[model samples]
Target: MKITLIIPTYNAGSLWPNVLDAIKQQTIYPDKLIVIDSGSKDETVPLASDLKNISIFNIDSKDFNHGGTRNLAVAKTLDADVIIFLTQDAILADSDAIKNLVYYFSEPLIAAVCGRQLPHKDANP
Candidate 1:
């Protein structure tokens, strides 16, 4: 099954690279990686451009709406059997995190799945 991963980014900040690294190391990678950036003034766009096989779409900052931006990316990924949406700051917890999540779709009754969030090592309890 074709899987597409979409991430909507603005000013993703310094941690964005780490998030992208985690995705690059995933055991089961998506067939397509799309980044919809809304006029970031930082390095978000250039950093994302460094990655190979990534499709980046830029929109005016004024035009961004949380749900609308996601829908915009979805429109371009209509051919994918599975579409995964992630926030810019969310880093996958492990190499198999996505693989584990995607496998659930194999069950005929499973329509959606959510991943558990673990606090970062630097996060205060």
Candidate 2:
């Protein structure tokens, strides 16, 4: 299936590379990867440019609303059969992470799917 991966980022900082690297190693490569940047003052764009299948969309930070900002990215993927949304803070656990989510679509009844969000390793809890 044609899939589009969208990431919303703002000053992603040092952790961004890990996320990008994990995405690059995904077992099921996305047909397209769109980064909806909320005016990052850092190197997020420069770092993300090193990867293929990625596109960047910049917007003012004040305009960002978690839901609507993501919706904007979805609208850009009108041709995609499935749209996956990931945040810059997310570190993909394995190459199959995306594949695991996309696998459900074959069932025909699953309209959308999402993975569990795990706490960072250093979390207080």
Highest-scoring model, lDDT: 2
List where candidate 2 sits over 4 angstroms from the true fold.
Answer: 123-125
| lDDT by residue for model 2 (1-125), tens | 99899999999977799899999999999999999999999999889987788889999999999999999998888999989989887889999999999999999888878798787775346
RMSD of model 1 against the true structure: 1.9
Worst 10 residues of 1 by lDDT: 116-125
Candidate 1 lDDT tens digits, 42-111 = 9998988876568999999899999999999999999988889988888899899789989999998998
> Distance from true position, residue 15, model 1, in Å?
0.7
What is the clash count of model 1? Answer: 0
Off by over 4 Å in 1: 121-125
Query: Candidate 2 has which clashing residue pairs, if any?
Result: none
> TM-score, each model?
0.92, 0.94
What are the lDDT figures for the candidates, one per model? 0.90, 0.91
